[model samples]
Target: MTVMELSNLSVTLRRRDVIRDVSLSVGKGEFIGLIGPNGAGKTTLMRAALGLIPFVGNSSLAAMPLAERAMAVAWMPQQREIAWPVTVETLVMLGRTPHVGALASPTDHDRSQVDAAIRWMGLDDMRQRAATRLSGGEQARVLIARALAQDTPFVMADEPVAGLDPAHQISTMQTFARLAEQGKSSLVSLHDLGLAARHCTRLVLMSEGRLIADGCPAHVLTPERLAEVFGISAWYQDTEQGPVCQPLEVIR
Candidate 1:
């Protein structure tokens, strides 16, 4: 089954087109990595999929119309300046809001899910800590936990590991892979070509608000294609760890 489908998707902000004529279909249990340079409309496409932005095209989730898309899709944006001093556990519990009744308190099942999400993200030690006090990497994981608590069929992440160290980045990618293995579809936007190649089942490359390539990472992330889109002279080689992207220098 197609978990998410976008047809002729277009998004404009203040009359400037950010995404144009984009169409893609993500199947159930597929882990797709969207790679693009800054200002390439990766986030805009994600927002359109979530029905957060007004667009001219059609998008649907699980064969349902776009009206109820958010219920079936969970989104984790790039960590921003969050001033709220809520506990990590409490923050994750917020993911249950979409599933709860209006003005109702969280039930035991919700709390248990939150707890499991914390453990899934390896944040059991920081469950009671304030979100504002955690390190950047820790905060990213906490946000991911919150998204996981949603228990949606399709998950979308914007730069899920943008600020994390190498170890944490790998951990987060592995977590996403596990989720996909469990039959959940995940669409993640990433800047790390090597990590995306190693983790994602498919790659979607975008540039200038347009999708340039969509296929297996090994075939899509060639040096010539990377240079054409990213303006970086790079060589891609397969190693024991997976495909490694080596950027030799900037191609001016």
Candidate 2:
């Protein structure tokens, strides 16, 4: 099943195209790694798809009513700003608001959801800590756990692993991969080609506001594409540990 679809999507800001004509579909159980250079419009595409920005195109996810969309998809934006001095548990429990209602107290199921999300992000020990007091990387994990607690079928995360430690980064990707196995889909924008290649079931390569390539990890992370789009050379191999890919050097 296609969980999200964007057809001929385009976004303009200041009379310039931030996201040009682009189209893509995210399906059930597929971990889609949205990869591209810094200004490739990956962020704009996700925002436009979520109806958060003005755009010219059709996005099935964007078409849904706001309330319905909130329950259908969970979004973890790149910015990690903890506005409230809430505890880790309180913040994650907020993810259940759509189901529990803002004024209603959490039920057993909501508590369970928050617990699971906290455990997945290795925050069990700090569940009672104030979110604003945590370090940058720890704060990132807390925000991720909040998204996980939402437990939506479709998850869209922008640079979710940006500030995480090496172990947490891999673990976070693994968490998304496990979710995919359970028929959930995740569209994640990542700068770490190695992690994206190893964990994602499919990859979409964006360049200059367009999707330049889409396929399995091997196909999308080809050396030529790396050089052309990323201006770098990378090493890729099929190993017992799985497909390993790393940018070797900036050849351009």
RMSD of each: 2.0, 0.8
Model 2: residue 148 alpha-carbon error in angstroms? 0.9
lDDT of candidate 1 vs native?
A: 0.87
Best candidate according to lDDT: 2
TM-score for each predicted model, relative to the true structure: 0.93, 0.98
Worst 10 residues of 1 by lDDT: 61-70
Model 2, 188-241: lDDT tens per residue?
A: 999999999999999999999999999999999999999999999999997888
* lDDT, residue 187, candidate 2: 97
What's the residue-level lDDT of 151 in candidate 2?
89
In candidate 1, residue 4 scores what lDDT? 85
Q: Kindly list the per-residue Cα lDDT of model 1 for residues 1-252, writing each as its tens digit.
A: 888889999999998999999999999889999998889899999988777778888887534553365578888987555579999998998888887777999999999889888988899999999999998888989999999999888899999998888998998899889988999999999998889988899999999899999999877898778889888887787789777776688896
